[model samples]
Target chain A: MAPTFTTLGYLTAGLYTASLACYLRKLFAEGKWAGRAATLLLAAGLATHYFALLVRAYSIHSVPYQDLYGSTSLLAWFLVLTYLGLELIHGERAMGAFILPLVLLLLMLDFVATPHAAPAAPARGSVFALHVTSNILAYSAFTLSFVYSVVYLVQDRLLRGRRPIAIMWRLPPLEDLERMARSGVWVGLASLMVGIGFGMVVDRQVTGAMLQFDPKVVISFLILGFYVLYLTVSRSPAWRGARASVLCVVNYFAVVFSYTAVNLFFSRFHRFY
Target chain B: MSVYLLGVNHRTAGVALRERLHFSLEDGVRAGESLRRDGLVDEVVVLSTCNRSEVYSVVAQGAAQPEGGLERYFCSFHSIEPAQLNGCLYHRRDRDAVEHLYRVAAGLDSMLLGEAEILCQVRETYLAAQRAGLTGPILNRLFQAGLEVGKRVRAETRLGAQAMSVASAAMKLAEQIFGALKNNSAAVFGSGAMGAKAAQQLRSRGIGRLWVANRTPEHARELAARVGAQWAPWEKSAELLAQVDIVVTSVAGSEWSLTREALAAAMHARGNRRMFLIDLGVPRNIDPAAAGLYNVFLYGVDDLEEIVEQNRQARESEVPRAEAIVREHVEKFAAWQSGANAVAALADLRRKLRLQREIFTDAHREELAQFPAEERERILRLMDELVEDLLREPSERLMKDREVRERAVLLRDLFGLNAPDSSRRGGE
Candidate 1:
């Protein structure tokens, strides 16, 4: 018998996500550490999340991408990992202020999206691992970028208004914000490139492949295209601060549409998963 | 008596005008002497830096006598018209003069706020004037307070570090894009303070090719060559423009020396290599439009101010520590300056008692120390007690009151007492 991911799965993920969001809010609002206790709680949640994902994957003897429940669990894990990667790149523990709450929300949605798990079993096909990983990786990158864009927007607004966002003054300087936005976009672009490549590879192999002109795939490509344009504008047009922010926000929602609109609501092509 | 500070600064005058009015160290000593001989002032200290030429002095305690003596004296010293100096003059009396000195020393009255060296320069000039027997009790008290205030402003505010001087900031922007500037080439187009500072920066960063091209070629050529570069003659800058990496232009504000056409032509001639043009000149010697050229960076004072403002904001977060340092400096200065004033009262009381003793000795018709030993001891003890009693009040007043501190010069002047001069005979 495997140690199945319980409600703790959602709590662990949701707690970290919530903590990050609160920290970001505090950073912008007060420009100071709001709660070390909350930070510790989020760290604990991340640990528990790692354990849960590992246990479930071990019991199933696969990457845990078979049923909807496994997919939800994997999404939560990918989000946290993406967040930590972003933190490492930018030395921005503040993004966790926004990132962890999101992870927690997704974990809670895990409860709503997939209640009880079926008996432990290997994924239906090899492509299952490929499809699941690529989608979440790209989606997580998109999410992180959106966070950066939001901060950039807030900072930009404050600068223009000759005021401070109060909380954001604690985040980073304007240059640092610009650097963050650029870094986030770069990560997103890389993630989209890899995820799209893997999608094509797995589509050719998996039967009734999810990427068969599916709306999800279409939306994902659209999301990728948006960010590509974002990069272009940033480089050539010097689309800075505000303009980059808009692209980030729009791309984020495109990600949400790809995952939710094509998964739970329109599951025609992804029915195999 | 009002203190007066009338002078041309970097802002009000172009470099040529400023230089013409600027007094060298020798000129400064001579100017002080002339002011003394002409009875233009009772106490005079001339601050003739590149940015400003100020005369901090005490006038008769009334409206300037219309003999035009001070004006004539300055005219004779500079060999400039009284009318020409009139438009450049700003007359401040008493408190305003005191405030002006303090603010200048604090870098508040500077072209760039809170510059570090000006305060020390003011201190040095004040000390020199004192040594020259120019500064009396009033000037001494005023200058000491000003120096302390300077330290306070520099410490308590972001004025020192956050105030990115036009020269240094242009250097910083270059460093930002190029990383370390050790391998960079910086061209200085003016031989003024700002240009000199920029040159110093280039030298400090190990800049391999430094160019100091000024209208006055002789001014900074030695400096340029020492920094491992040849002096680019003012007219030859176009030929050499394509050769340098960074161009710092601070030529006279009215001149269009580093025009867009010239810099662009240089860029094109250099095969479109990246060049950073920093215009420290107020009127913008390098055209703002030049920044649009590919790989060309152009920035003026306003742009540098933007950086300063941003730095100031970040500095806001770090100000508490700086304020603490400033507060400590303020207290230290206040203590010493006030203590010096109090010591004057003690000296006065001691002098008066000694005078009385001399009178008694004459009546007794004995040697000074030959009075009955017991009587002499008693007299000395009475003198000590009287001086201490007199000093206690002034000391307590100085320690307890800001009003006294603010009016220290006037108070000292009124009492005909002085903080024993720091440089002369050891203070009592």
Candidate 2:
């Protein structure tokens, strides 16, 4: 079963890579067929990735978010979902070349790290499962926001520098990139708020306390605060374009620290295999 | 009989020559009717646009070529000397003609690559010929196929996606700055041709609340009415600039029309909302320094040229793909024409066989009068069976065998199976 899941994981990654190639081809060429094929391939990869997650959960006899590898895989899956959702809504696929590689990297990491799965920790109930799932989803949304902000900045630089390249034509319009990033931030902030709410509930039930000063908790709040600040600043026209994009990028780093550094070396209550 | 296309385009002829040879709708109708009536061509459709004038026709096989062909007919109808028009005219016959028509309809052959006006011109030409009672089955099928090819190329390739003109490029830049123009208001300063074109493009893009302002109030009002936009006074540029999300200026002068200070004040009034300014004038209209302000995007004529060049290159790169599509359709049309010819040949052969049987039977009627009616009927049926058996192998070969397919016209001529009906000669 583990071998089968591993094969599925590899197949999913391979499909995503193929989709990325098709998108890149479309960016340079002028054919609708390439864009359509890329989209179909990406959706296929997402299906296989979902199946792999289900199989992993079944094999381990628990939700797949019990450890670092499983949670990262879930995060990668949500990232693809968010991106695909945006693509469908906007009918824009040029950004897929920039975005799908990040998803593939996370999935590859999951594939490599899951083989050395550590011993299972004590069982956590549905509340803890929900909390972890929402938190990972929030992180996924923030990652997408990070990608859009980076694209927005690149487009801004190209337009301002008056050094337009072939890729400039393929990138989404600057306004569209900014709007997509703002939408991602909204998703991220809302999910983070809900996830933290559930986290507080679980902490109260398990430790008979509401606010345990865990390092992960502290960093999660910091990440949430940064995004909230970004949202606030984005409403003002003066802080809207480059300034807002920069702040979004900065918030993503805090997200990285919370998801990785705090999980690996700092947090006690949230430490996992 | 085969289809032929003869014409000159911007590449092959100068504007002076093209204008002299240009055909209006009435002129095309007259030419098509005269050509068909004179038996110079079996069917005709004349496509005339600013960039090209093409005449598509079907002529009889083995017709008198030099004295009464399409070229001489075109020259005589237009009262132009054949020698003078010789250098400008190009001729494509049969499959090549079909391919040329498709390419023209698809905009691949336009002066500006992927421009769409030629398609509409072709459609109108076809309809005009049709209304004049000049089109037959062959020409009809060809024009329909050309139109479909045009639509497919546009949908399947990005050939028609980019803007090739400065006016359109400015609109594209505005779209990049503001995602959807549907909610954005735009103001066009100066009622010159370029500014008017930019306003028209913006209106076509569904920009809301378009305002036209010019140094001359009458020109501004006229331009605004023409494009269905509101006219604003030139002195109200500050208020208009603050209200509109986009501003396009094409006013000509040595001095600046919109300085940075005025724009800054407008920006401040609008709460620093994102604004796109396009200056298409010489010596500059909008101050270039305004680009440095936050949330303000400014582009001049030179900046738009970069986009136009990029778009041109992109369209040029897609030429090969568009050509491939044209080639595929041309081949399909050739195959269909082959099948059509084969069908015509088979029908002719059957008709000839029936005529021969009737003549032989009529000649032997006296001898058959000696026998009973039933016996005569059996004898006639036997003769019919023999004819069917004798022709079966050749009929199947005509449809299937490529080597035999080329002999279809020869067989038709050998059997003297030419239709007495001139209408069928035009097409089915």
User: How many clashes (backbone atoms < 3 Å, residues ≥3 apart in a chain or on different chains) does model 1 have?
Assistant: 20
lDDT by residue (A1-273, candidate 1, tens digit) is 344455566567566756766676555433234455456666677688777777777776756655566666677677777766656565556666666666666655545653454544444465546655776776766777777778767755544333432254346544555566667667766766776777677676665453477776677778878888887775442354466668778877877777776776775655434
TM-score of each: 0.46, 0.87
**Cα lDDT tens digits for candidate 1, B380-399:** 67866776686677667766
Worst 10 residues of 2 chain A by lDDT: A110-119
Proportion of true inter-chain contacts also present in candidate 2: 0.56
Best-matching candidate per DockQ: 2
Local error of candidate 1 at residue B82 (angstroms): 44
Q: Write model 2 residue lDDT over A17-80, tens digit each, in one string.
A: 9999999888876677889999999999999999988988888777877666677789989999
Cα lDDT, all candidates: 0.65, 0.84
Runs of candidate 1 with Cα error greater than 4 angstroms are A1-45, A54-80, A86-123, A142-211, A221-256, A262-267, A271-273, B1-188, B202-221, B226-247, B257-278, B286-428
* TM-score, chain B, predicted structure 2: 0.83
Model 2 residue pairs with clashes: none
The parts of candidate 2 lying over 4 Å away from their true place are A4-48, A88-93, B8-38, B63-90, B127-134, B185-191, B209-244, B257-271, B286-290, B349-383, B412-428
DockQ for model 2? 0.45
